[model samples]
Target: MKIKTGRRVASALGGAALALGITLGTAGTANAWTADWETVDDGHGVGIYNGPSSTSGKHGFHDLYTPDEVYLICWIRGEDIANQGNVWYRTSEVYYYRIGSYNLWGNYYVYGAYVDNYYAFHHRLDECKS
Candidate 1:
């Protein structure tokens, strides 16, 4: 009977350890960036803008290299490009760029045309409050 009790205790401890590990693992992932990273399909690179419109001289602060993955925070309806719709995704992560002698990094907006066509579907992205 003593040997059986010892085995039961060990089994219980192992189960507890497993549960703790799972909890910790999930917690670790939760701390990571919550947005999905998508690749920019444009081979020539795409411009990262302050606003959704490319025609806006105030926007397009930096250029995001093509085939790079960007963390999209949300979406908004703005100027249409290449007849690809007016959808745009706002990025949450900073990108590095050089302007003349200075290097700069900032978060910016990307047109949906640079991303997959699937993103054009309605409700595919969380709309930005702005």
Candidate 2:
């Protein structure tokens, strides 16, 4: 199929825009988060981080990102797909806890952690009065 000149231009522009968006989205400060811990045995264990310590300072001093209404959040970080563990696989239960003197600041983050067998964890329902 022959695309018109205008259509071709628009298509090219759209593709370019999409590519730019993808690049910008992934681009960020290096070491944005602290590698508090990483799996020693192949990616089976897991990697723990206090907060993003990138040059951008994305996570600031918080331990994790609180849900929109103070609820569930992805408070854990893994190296790659191999390390991205879920609430299964007979692994340690990652629980984010408060650390440092930033107690009253909110969003304690994933710290003061250890290891425990976890089956699953999903609390979509929050204490919202909706």
Candidate 3:
């Protein structure tokens, strides 16, 4: 009976430590910029102006962006993309993908899957941006 009680206490401590580590890993120190992101209204529908607010929308997506950070938008650039097309325009270069639904904020790799709710996916993320 005593051994079982000891095991439960150790398990609780371990679980608490694991949760704390995950929470700390996802956050960063304070900065002038807002951790909460916003979408830019450029008359291009879902296009976002991600530059630092202090810069007046210049020199953005060029510096100060982390790879793990993700944003969603819908816009037309260069050629018209196909349903399965994955191409990058000016921002974020060739790595950008027009994804649907499933969140890829954790370096998710996708292949050979057809998504029906592309617009809905964008709308979901766009609304989250405030």
Candidate 4:
């Protein structure tokens, strides 16, 4: 009886150690936010905005050409374009035609209608606050 009780106690401690090891191994190694890539509308490069709306003014401002990919950060509701949904995506970076890729400093917006996956990310992306 004594031997069986000791075995159970050792097994429980081993399980706890394994769980803690896993938790510590992954700590601080994951990104705080999720990101994905979406291609720009073919032949129609779009402008990057400072805010969710076009009227928000351009921030770190630049244009993204068709075939160019935008690294999406998140989305928010904004002014409508071409009668399309009033949605816009916040992008982190863009590539210029003649220049190399540039980082938008993380505070820029692109009209959803201008991206190929405009409809696909509506539910997948986390909405921007305010």
Residue lDDT tens for model 4, 28-69: 111223445566777566878876687888754457766555
Please report how far candidate 4 places residue 75 from its true position, in Å: 1.4
**If the candidates were sorted by their TM-score against the true structure, best first, what order would they fall in?**
4, 1, 2, 3
In TM-score terms, which candidate is top?
4
Q: What TM-score, computed on C-alpha atoms, does each candidate reach? A: 0.54, 0.18, 0.18, 0.61
Query: After TM-score superposition, what is the CA distance of residue 2 in candidate 1 from its true location, in Å?
Result: 52
Mark the regions of model 2 whose C-alpha exceeds 4 Å error after superposition.
1-58, 62-81, 84-100, 104-130
Candidate 1, residue 59: Cα displacement in angstroms equals: 7.4
Q: Report clash pairs, candidate 1.
A: none
The lDDT of each candidate is 0.52, 0.24, 0.24, 0.58
Q: After superposition on all CA atoms, what RMSD does each candidate show versus the true structure? A: 15.7, 18.5, 15.9, 16.2
Q: How accurate locally is residue 54 in candidate 3, as Cα lDDT from 0 to 100?
A: 21
lDDT tens per residue, model 2, 82-120 = 333422111111222223212121222222121222211
Worst 10 residues of 4 by lDDT: 23-32
Q: Write the per-residue lDDT of candidate 3 for residues 4-91, one digit (tens) a residue.
A: 4543454344335434433222322222121122222222222213221222243222222112112222122222234544321112
Model 1 alpha-carbon miss at residue 71, Å: 0.8
* Runs in model 1 lying further than 4 Å from the true structure: 1-34, 42-44, 57-62, 94-105, 118-124
**lDDT leader:** 4
For candidate 2, which ten residues in a row score worst on lDDT? 29-38
